[model samples]
Target: MEKFPQMGGELHKIFGSPESPFKTVSDNILQYTCGKRAECIELRRKLLEPKDAHLAKLLTGIPPSSTALFEERLLAEFVRAHPSTVRPKPRNPPRLPPPASVQPFPSTQPRRERDPALQVQEHKGSWHYCFPIQAQGHQEQPLTQQ
Candidate 1:
């Protein structure tokens, strides 16, 4: 079922990563299941400890202090916790340098504002406009200063 792949996914990821000596999922599983695997035995032993028991309880929505639910909860929770597969992200190719024929612009002039009086400012992630408004038959009213 999905559980097999999910457990395999974490194991497979760790194998490819710096954590495990095995190169593939099948190799890791075969080694663990076949002999008296020290690593596998140690990991299984740790799962019965208080810390892992707490995690199991949290994942299974059982009260943390309840010791009776540890074994069943741990097995169910651990499988459900990890995803079935985690595909590596695709890396972007390096950008090529611009051709020698293309020349860089040497202009150093400051950008000119179309309207000098109408200043715009950002406040608390929102843009505020400081400009005058002219209502019908009313004098030009400057925006209220925030």
Candidate 2:
């Protein structure tokens, strides 16, 4: 089989050829040794070539390469620029005054001639009354007859 130069020496030189220690080892070797470290450094250098250092500085406090930082800052600025909401004080219902006019009348009536003869005495917390017979000449007589 014929050996290809691009797939062999040229590509290996550009990506930092493997060290002398890995010279005797097979290319299919999976384990890490001194040669693997050199090749990894070369690859890292190539990958970082397109990065912008100034852009990195501008986004110092933000999460690494994430869009959430811009969105959060924009929302905060919008909230600060807008006017705050005003809430009206709570109002109490109006109180109604008492009625303007009131009429007064007496509850008790005067005793009549034909009314029952009742003798009242206060005993304990209640009033006790005695009823007398309605005689023709005994209308003005005392309730207790000794």
lDDT digits (tens) for residues 7-88 of candidate 1: 7778767677655656566676888775655455446545543444554454445323323433566555654764332234
Best by lDDT: 1
Model 2 agreement with the true structure over 1-146: per-residue lDDT tens digits: 15664566655654546754345354446445546855665565344332456533433333221333234664455335432312244698576743444323232335556545667655554555545764544343333422
**TM-score to native of every candidate shown:** 0.17, 0.16
Residue 111 lDDT in candidate 1: 70
Q: Which candidate wins on TM-score?
A: 1
**Candidate 2, after superposition: displacement of residue 99 in Å?**
13
Error of 1 at 45 (Å): 85
Off-target runs (Cα >4 Å) in candidate 2 are 1-101, 107-116, 134-146
